[model samples]
Target: MTALHCDGSLTADRASYGGIIRDDNSVLGMELLAILRGVTLCIQKDLLRVSIRSYSKLAVDILNGIVSCPWSLQALKVRITSLMEQLQRKEIRHVWRELNQPADFVAAIDTGDGESFFYPPDFPLDLVELIKNDSDRKTYFRTPSH
Candidate 1:
């Protein structure tokens, strides 16, 4: 249930990085819902790009349903509806597990039950290194920089 994010600009700089630890794990639907909720909190802008590792097909369907016709049990409708409205411009895609190892590592860390944490821009050295490697790996598709 941990969330990490960073934002910086030419004149000013900012970073929103944190992690949330749930008490325990559950089914795939609940897990996906929890992660989505965490991600919504981390967003700083109207547009967002997301990459997921588990339950790829299910995740895509859920997200698309939110944008198109959001329907869920009474208990979950509010959260899903809110997220749909909040996300004005977004792209959600499933990626290889190897590609998301860093995020998985962060989420897997034990931050204590119901505990949360935040880090500076350069914190989590291991995760940063993984990101660098993934960006450079040839098997990972990349478009030339403009």
Candidate 2:
């Protein structure tokens, strides 16, 4: 369909930089939590429709920016404490930076493009695919609620 074609062309894979990488573990973790929530929202929103095509990638880029930081653990503790007090949010993960990079990269860039030219990398795949595949089988948000 004309609309589907247009939407497909402007998918989440077109996002830009994830954000200023912060090495703080606490802040990075909290940021990651926010990002995960945002990503879930995107998946549920059925963005691959003509309705949001024009601003789709920007949405994704912003989400990636929130979740993919490289802040330090000490800085993270202070940052997370301040963020929690300010936003009333909590930090969830305590994982290493290397473990999170793939998710970060996929969200910020299309995996199909290949990395040499920053087109897309073969080693890294889209995290959205994982989310879509793992989603509830009978509950696509795009479908009319029963």
Candidate 3:
């Protein structure tokens, strides 16, 4: 499944953990990504002390949608809130589609004889691609050796 890290800016005291709920309309793969991300972190830190395995491409795409979910409408917010309260947690993990392109490619772009894009009733291809491309290009330019 797709796993990612996110960072947010703060002005005053501290930043709220930024977490997104996957779009429920999509497949459960996105949810799996969130779970996998947590599992991955725990394994890396040797905290939970458990074995972890990567998820399939389908799972990753689903996770991408999940990562884009707005927590305000997600039911998982309650559990997150409770856990944070008990742990004094501040940082939130999130998986965004752009950052998890491998899955996106497998599910859409890399699919054999398949379409690589979608156009919602109001969404424009150029605009969306333009924004994503612009950000990536910016990053490439800002690299230390650039």
Best by lDDT: 1
Q: What's the true lDDT of residue 63 in model 3?
A: 31
Over 22-85, each residue of candidate 1 has an lDDT whose tens digit, in order, gives 3222334464665566566656543455433443445555555643322343345345546655
**In model 2, where is the ten-residue run with the lowest total lDDT?**
48-57
lDDT of 1 at 107: 72
TM-score of each: 0.54, 0.25, 0.24
For lDDT, candidate 1 versus 3, the one ahead is 1
**Residue by residue across 1-146, what tens digits does model 2's lDDT show?**
11111222345667343334333343335554444444344445643221111122322333324443343333433443343333322323333333444444444664466433222343434554544444533232444458
Best by TM-score: 1
lDDT of 3 by residue, 9-118 (tens): 78788766675544433444344544444544454565643322223343433233443434443454334333334332233334344444433433444336733444
Task: List the candidate numbers ranked by TM-score, top first.
Answer: 1, 2, 3
